[model samples]
Target chain A: MQPTDLTPHAEPELIVFRDVSVHFPVFNASTRSFRKRVIQVATGGIVAPDHTGHIVVQALTNLNFGIRSGERVALFGHNGAGKTTLLGALSRIYAPTSGSAEISGAVGSLINISLGTDPESTGRENIFLRAAILGLGRDFIQKNLEEIIEFSELGDFIDLPVRTYSSGMQLRLAFAVSTMLRPEILVMDEWLSVGDKNFQSKAAARLDAMLRDTKILVLATHSRDLALRHCNRALWLEHGRIKLDGPVKDVAAAYFGK
Target chain B: MLENLKAAMADIARSRHYASLIHILGWQDMRHRYRRSFLGPFWLVASTAALVATICLILGPMFGLPPEQYVPYVAAGMIVWGLIVSMCTDSCQAFISQSTMIRQTAAPLFTYVARVAWRNTLLFAHNLVIFPVALWISGAHSNMNALLAVPGFLLVLANLAWIGLVLAILSARYRDLPKTIDSVIPVLMFMTPIMWKPEMMPLRIGVKILQFNPFYWMIDLVRVPMMGGIPPGKVWVGAAVVALVGWVVALILFARTRERIVYWL
Candidate 1:
C-alpha cells in the first residue's frame, strides 16, 4: 500500500497493520476453575505437552493493511468474519498476539456509544461520564456541554435521571455525547442510526461535519449502500482473513455478488 | 518478559493522567450505591460508628479491658480493618465489574484498579470519622504521635493498591479466585488481632503467627499510629517490604496477563 492514493497529507499513514493476528485463548469452565487447575498441578495430570492443549480461537490472522489520512475504509464480512475484531484491534481494545499494529492518532469508537452511561445518573452527568470514558478531558466536555445538549434536543430533560427518559430520549443523550469526540481516527461498528427520522437527519448532518474533520475513518458494517456511499476503500474479510482489498465499488460488487 | 514489564509500568504511570476520569467514576460508584438513601455516604459512617460502639460496649468487657483502654484500640482496628477487607474483596471484581468498559475502551488496566483503590479510600475516610468519636468517648488522649497515621495510612494504601491490582488481574482470568478470596478474608479477620488485643493470645503460637501475618503488620502500620503509638521499626520494615515485593509480583502478573484480560472476559 502506497501513500499516493489520497490527498497531499503531511502524515504518511494513520493506521498500519503488518501481519497482525489476534488469538483468544478460550478458558472454559474447566480451564478457568482454580480447583481443577490446582488438582492438575498436584496430581501431575492433564499436563498437555504445550499450549496446543488449550482452546484458542483465531479471531484475526495475518491482516496486512494500511489506512492513510483522508481515506474512508469499510470492513465487510460475514457475522464471524473478523470485521469487528479488526476494528477492535484498530481502536486498541485487542492487542495483536503476533506481528504489529501501530495507530498514531486518538481513536474515537462509536462501537458502543452508551458505553459508560449510567442509568441512575442524570443525563448531564452521563454526558460527562461517557465523554470521560472516551478519554476526553474535562475542559473539552465542559466547553461543549451546551452545544451537545442543544444538538441532542434534550433541553430541560438533561437534568433528569437517564432512567426516567424514554429509550429514544436516552439514545439522543448518548448520541449527543458521542458526537462530541473530535478524534483524528474515527471508528464505527455500524453507521449509528440514532433516534427518530427527524433526529436521524440531524444526526447525519452532525456526523458528516464530524467526518469532515476526521483524518481517517474505519467503519465495519453490512450495509453495501452505506459502504459504497461513504467509503472510498473496502476490505472483504472471510473467516478472519482479508479476502479482497480495493476500491469500495469493486470490492462490494465482488463480495456482495455482481 | 522485560518488554511486558515495561508496558505494565507504563500502564501504571499513564493511569495517573486519567485521575479526573477515575475520580469521577469512583465518586459515581459511591453515589450509585447510596443514591436513594437519605444519609448517602453517611450511611457508611453510621454503620461503622454502630459497629465500633457495639464492640466497645460488648467486646470491651468480654475481653476484660476497660473502655478507656479498649475503645480506641478496637475502633482504630475496626476502621483500618474495614479498609483492608473491602479493598481486597472489592478489587476482586474491579475488572469483572468493568468488563464492558474494558472490552470496549483501551483505557489503562490500572485505571480500573485505581478506581477500586480510590473508592475504598473514600470509604476509609468515612470510617476514619469513627476513630475521633471513639477517642472522645473513651477519654483517651492522642498526642502528636497520631500525626504519624498520615504517612502510615499512605503506606497502607500503597500496599493495598498492589494487592488489589494482583487480585483484580488474577480473578479476572481465574473465575474462582474471587470466591476463594471471599472465604479466606473472614478467616483472616479471626486470625488477625482486630476485635481483641494481642495480649489475649497465648504467646508461643500467637506471636509467631502474627509475626508472619502480613495483615497484622498492615493493620499495625495504621492502627498503632491512630491510637497514638509508633509502630515498631520491624512493622514498618515488614509493611514496606510487602509493598515493594507485592508490587513487583503484581507488575509481573499484570504484564503477563494484561493483554489477555479482555479475552478472559
Candidate 2:
C-alpha cells in the first residue's frame, strides 16, 4: 500500500483504501446484563480480545483498492458478498478497523434517498429537508427549489404532506431532491429504479446528469446490463475481498461466467 | 489515553463540519412535533405554569414558605428539571431514534446528541416564559447574580451532552439498558429536589443527601439564580466537577466506541 493511499492528504484524483478492513463486535445479548457481565468478569473468564466476550464478525477484511477520479466503478458479487459494504466503506458510513480509506471529495450515498424525508411534511418542505440531510446548504436548496419541484411533477401535491402522496410520488420527490446537486463522489446501491415508466426516464436523465458531473462513482448492483451500460470498470467482491478488478467487460465476463 | 483523547477531539472537530445540518434538523424536530397544533408549543408553557401553580399551592404550606417565595423557586426548579430529566432519558434513544441517519450517513455522532439537546433547549426556552412572570409576581430582585445563570445554563447544557453521549452509546449496544434507565429515571425524579427544595427536607438527612445528589446541583445551579442570589460554593464546585468528570469519561468512551456504534445500530 502506498503511503499516499492511506493518508487523506491532497490526493485530489484518488479514492484509496490501503488494506482496509472492518470488524463488528457482536456483544452477546445474554451477557449484556449488568449482573451477568460483572459475574463473568469477577470469575476471570476470558471473554475474548475485547474483554467483553463479543464475537467479532469480519465484514470487510484486507481490502486493497483505489478508484481514481472520473472513474465509475461497478461492484459485482452475490448477496452478502460485501458489495454493499464496500460501497458503504467508500461512502464513509463504516470506518475501516485496520489500514485506512481515504475518500477525497464530498460523498453522497444514494443507498436510501428517502432517509431524510418526514412523512408529516409537505413535498416542498421534504425537498429542502432531504437535500439538507445530504449536506446541502440552505441557499443552494433554495436556489434549486423550483427546479427540483418541477422535476418531480407533483406541482399541486407539493403543498400537501408527503403521507398524502402515494408511495410512488413520495419516492419521486425524494429522488429528485437527492440527485439535484452533483456530488464529487456518488455511491449508489442500485440504479434507483422508481416511479412509473414516464418518471423512470426522468429519473435516469437526472442520474445521468449527476453521473456526468460527478468525479467518482462507486455503484453496487446485480444487473450486468446496468453495469455494462454505465460503468467503465468493475470490481467483484467475494466475502469482502476483491476477487477481480479490471475493465468492465473483462471483470463482468469473469464474474458472470463468460 | 492521550492518543484516544486526541482522536476524540478530532472526531468532535466535525461538529463544525455538520453544524448547519444539526441546526436545521433540530429546528425541524421542534416543527415536526408542533406542526398541526393550533396552540402550538405554547401549550408547553401553559401546562408548565399550571403545574407550578398547583405545586406552589399544595407544597407551599408544607414547606412553610409563602406563595411568593415558593412559586418562583418551584417554577424555576420544575422548568430546569423538565429539561434535565427528559434530556437524560431521551439521550438513551438519541442514537436508537436516528438509526437510519447513523446507518446511512457518517456525520459526526455529536450531531444527534446536539439535536436532542437543542430541541430540549428550545422547549426549555418555551417553558422559560413562566420564570420571569413568576419572579415579577413574587417580587424577587433582578440582580447581577441572575446574570450568572447564563453560565449555569451553559454548564447544564455541557453536562447534558456528555451524559447523553454515554447513555446513548451504552443503550444502543444493549437494547435493555435504555429500558432499565427509563424506569429508573422516574424514581430518581422523586429522589431529586424538584418538587420540593433541599431546605424542606429534614436537616441531617436532607443536607447530607442534597450535597451528594448530582442532579440537585443541576437544578440548584439554575434555580438559585432566578431567585436572585449566587449559588453557594458547593453548587458551583459540585456542578463543575461533575461536568468535567462526565465529559472526560464521555469523550474517552466515544473515541473507543464511536466506530462500533454503526454496527450496534
Candidate 3:
C-alpha cells in the first residue's frame, strides 16, 4: 500500500477528538488471581457489574475538541480532573474508550520531562538516551548534540555523571534535550522554570524560542497567569468532563469566577 | 477494541522510528550492564565455561566417554541451551521493564521487546566462544558441514525474536508468567539433552521427550554442526514450522493486546 496518507503537509496538524471517553477497568478481586479467573472463565464467562469485578474508571467522558495548527491551548483542572487524560489521548498514549482521537503530526512530549534519563550516566549519555526516547533519530541527535550541550550551558558538568548534578542542573539538561527537537505538536504539563535565577532566564528564553514555530502547543497547567500568557485557547476539565472550552479570557473568567 | 488492536499492530509495524531506539537501547544495555566489570561481557564466557566444566566432571565418567569428546558435546549443548532458556525467561520482561518509557512516550511495544532480544543476542555471541575451542579440544576438524551451524544459529535468533515478542505481551499482563517460566526453564533444561546424551536413554523415552521439546531441534541445528556432524533434515523442518507458526500466533496476539499492555504495567 502507498504510504498511508496522514494529515497533509503545509497545513496545521488537525487534532480532532470526537466524543472520546477513556475507561480504565480497575483490575479487582476476581481478576487478580489465576485460580479465581480460571473458575470464572470455565463457567462460560465473567459476570459482574460492567463485566465482572472491573470497576471502570471513567477517565474521560465524551471528550470532544478540535485543535488546529497555530492554536495554543491550555488545559486547567484540579487534581483528579481529566487534563492529563485528555493530553494522554492527544499523545495517543491512551486510546479512547469510545469515539475517536485523531491527530496528524509528529508529537513531541515533555511529560515527566526527564522520564527515561539515566542518572548513573554522564550528562552527555543521558542526553542521548532521552533523545532516543523522544523519538529523535541518532543522526539528528549527533548533528545537534553540541548545540544541545551548549544550550543547556552544562559546560564541564556534561562530562560528569548526572547522578552528581543537582536537581536544577539535571532539569536544565532535560529541558535542553527536550526542546532541541522542533516537533509539529508541542505538549507540556506546565510552564517550566529551572536552575538558579541566572540560568532560569536563559531557560525561559529557550522555551519561548522553542514555542515560536510549534504548529500546536498544548500546555496542561494550574497557573492562570501561565495559561493567559502562553495559550490563546483554554479547556477546563472537571471530573473527567469538559467544564468549558473557549477563548482564554472567557474560559478563564468563567472557571475562576467564584 | 479491534481498532485499538489495529492501531497497536500498526504502531508495532512502524519500525522506521523504533529500530534506531531498539538498537541503541540494546547496545547501551549491554554496555551498561558490564561497565564496571573488567572482563565485561567476557564474563558470560567464563561462567558458561565453569558450568560446562562442573557438569563434565560429574557426568563424564557416568557416560563412559573420554573427557575430550564429552566436554565439547556438553559445552556446546549448554551454550545453545543457555541462550534459548535466557530468551524464554527474558522475553517476559520486554515491555514490563520499560513501563516508564511506554507511559511517557509513544514508542511501539516491540521496541522494548527488541531491546531484550538484542541484549541477549550480544550475550549469546559471547557465549559462542566455546564452540570452536570445544571443536579443537575434542580433536575435531573444521569441515564444510561445520559452516551449517552458522545458518542454524541464525535460525535460532529468528525464532528468538518472535518468541520474545509473544512472551513480552503475555508476561506483561500476567504477573505469574515470568516466575512460572523461571521455574519451568531449569526443568526444561533437564528435559532437553544438555549434559546427558539421547543415546544413553531408552529409544522410546528419549524420542518421547525430544518430540515434545522444540529446543532439541533448535539446539541440534547448532549443536550437531558444531561437532562436525550434519543436523538431520527433520530438525530443520521442525525449526521452520516452529518459526512460522510462532510468528503467526505472536502477530495476532500482538495486534490484539498491544494497547492493553500499558494498563497492565
What would the TM-scores of all predictions be? Answer: 0.94, 0.88, 0.92
Candidate 3 wrongly placed segments (more than 4 Å): A1-13, A43-51, B1-9
lDDT of 3 by residue, B1-265 (tens): 5675676567767755767777777877887778889999888789898898788888888778887678888888999898898888888888788887787788877788777877888888899898777767666555677789889998898898898998888877676778878988988888888888777777776677677688877888988887779988878888888898988788888878876777777
Summarize candidate 2's per-residue lDDT along B140-240 as a digit string, tens digits.
Answer: 65577888888889988888889999999988877787888878888887889877766666677777866787778888888788778788987788788
Consecutive 10-residue window with the lowest summed lDDT within model 1 chain B: B197-206
lDDT of 3 by residue, A143-201 (tens): 99999898888899999999899888899899888888688898888888888888888
Candidate 3: the clashing residue pairs are none
Poorest lDDT segment (10 consecutive residues) of candidate 1 chain A = A2-11
Q: lDDT of each structure?
A: 0.88, 0.83, 0.82
DockQ (model 2, Cα): 0.46
Candidates' RMSD to native = 2.6, 4.2, 4.2
Q: What is the lDDT of residue A88 in candidate 1?
A: 88
The digit string of per-residue lDDT tens for model 1 on B1-265 reads 9999998899899888788779989998899889889999889889888988887888888878888789988888888999999999999999998888898888898999999999989988888888888889899878888899988889999999999999998898889999999999889999998898777886777777778888888888888878879999978887888899989999989899888888888
